[model samples]
Target: MDTTVANTGTEGKTWGGGNQPLKSSYGKMMMWFFIVSDALTFSGFLAAYGFSRFKFIGSWPIADEVFTHVPFFHGNYPMIYVAFMTFVLIMSSVTMVLAVDAGHHMKKTKVTWYMFLTIIGGLIFVGSQAWEWGTFIKGEYGAVQTNGGNILQFGKYETVDGNAVFKRVAVSDIAIDAHGERVEHERKNGLWFVDESALPAYTVDEVYNGLKANSDVLVRTQIINDEGEKTVLSREESLNQIKNNGKLVVQGANLQVNEYGTSLFADFFFFITGFHGFHVFSGVVINIIIFFNVILGTYERRGSYEMVEKVGLYWHFVDLVWVFVFTFFYLV
Candidate 1:
């Protein structure tokens, strides 16, 4: 006996075997699934970062001191460029909303213009992020790694507005190069198969000597005191620390060493921000494809602008993720 159920006009029912579920297209449902999964992934990454930072809360790099850079400017302007990038990305989301609204109205020209603006905003944000990565890796104020893997920075206390402010002193500004013959250890020249890393700008001895010569500059340890400022050593202690505990001259940030505090901070920064940057770049490419499709009247011929709405969903998700990332990494 065959047990087949007959269709009784259940195509538009809630549990009916239809393409649209919950009044949403299959494409939109899939997009929502992807966004939810991606959000979980980001949450896991951020949670891991939070735990690690808590483990090393006192030694973690300060965001303001680390990101005090602006394009083509020399002065220390904390969070200026990052703020600009966030604003641009948020505005792009606004433009995406306008594009989706225009698509609903079947206004192809308005949709095209809005999409174009969104693409431009994404490009600018991506470019700015790349520059920020470069600046982060290059580093600003150089430091020395101690024997116990602690970072020892050179700085001085200055009175600004009746408050004491710590000013960073670059290693190059203090250390006098000894003109020593430093050579890269190539695989061919060395006995081991692996090659060593490049030499730093100054030697430990040069840094020590420079520290001794500079009386005003003091040594700032990685430890944060009760007042939330890095513990600064006196002149005698500074000279003794450089003479006895200094291990190597560290310049920039990498997988191994970080001039700005712990290497773990740099690791998370690169991984999380790089992942978000990749998303932004992919969104930009997808928007370009959709923009051309709009110009060619693809959605217009289909009598629906749902494609624009779908892409807008993705763009808005990307923007929202960046907001969380910015808060976690920069503000918090």
Candidate 2:
């Protein structure tokens, strides 16, 4: 018996093992693959964040309260700077679109300009994120960590529009340093291989004394009450807590402590945002490389600006990821 094979009519078609499968080049297809994988990674991160947040929803740091800072401006402007960063990042995506369009049209000058604008926007966003991180780590108002690891903030309730609102009071404002000759423990000073962290600005005794001196100040626990506000303790309760349960004064956020609320919140904030920031920074660097190539007539000689379009895909993915992050991390 003899067997013979016949060619089907689908030869050279999209599914016929063509070089450009589904009308996409190999490079473009690879970029899409990378994007999909990266997207799944981000989804996993955000999902984990959501789960952790749900688990600690009551003691979670309020985004508005935590992100209430604007560069070169002083006041309680919640989400203002973050909103600005989002806007800049989105506008950079728009510029990337324009750059890709210009590349398709073979307009090198337009592509160059748009790519430059996109780079500038990325730089601005990265810088703003750095500033925000600095502010978060520095912490505005400090709090006391109870022996139970609960964070207790200080504030006073003020009437606004006939409604009571709690205003944050800085630990520096109320805490008076009374301890003398306090020093950080070094390896040489104590254990030969162990070292203690930096000393807090004020001791618990000093904080207790200061709270006693200030009649209006009250302690605010991280637990949210029925009215969707942090549970504020009465003066007597506040003093009792500081005098008995206060373990240490937390002035900022770190891997170990967070003045805003739980240390887990700070951990997630640093990890997720830092990961996203790394993506943005990488995109910026890649765009800079592609921008120089565009100026050098690299794509023009090839008669196709597919390179720009590929990088644009990555840039757009970064921007889109940030939208979800901003929503889940800030607005939600």
Provide the TM-score for each candidate, comma-separated. 0.92, 0.92
Which candidate should be chosen as best, given TM-score against the real structure?
2
Listed per model in order, the count of residue pairs whose N, CA or C atoms clash below 3 Å is 0, 0
Evaluate residue 23 in candidate 2 and report its C-alpha lDDT on the 0 to 100 scale.
65
lDDT of each: 0.88, 0.89
Clashes by residue pair, model 1: none
Question: Which digits, one per residue and each the tens of the lDDT, describe model 1 over residues 1-332?
Answer: 01111223444565553445356665667788999999999999999999999999988888988998999999989999999999999999999999988887889999999999999999999999999999999988899999988899999989999998888899999997788567788888887788887788888899998988888999999888998778999999999998999998998888888998888998999999999999999999999999999999888887677788888999999999999999999998
Candidate 1 local accuracy as lDDT? 0.88
- Measured by lDDT, the strongest candidate is 2
Model 1, stretches more than 4 Å misplaced?
1-17, 187-194
Candidate 2 CA-lDDT value: 0.89
Instruction: Give the per-residue lDDT digits (tens) of candidate 2, residues 1-98.
Output: 00111122333565553345346665677799999999999999999999999999887888888998899989999988888999999999999999
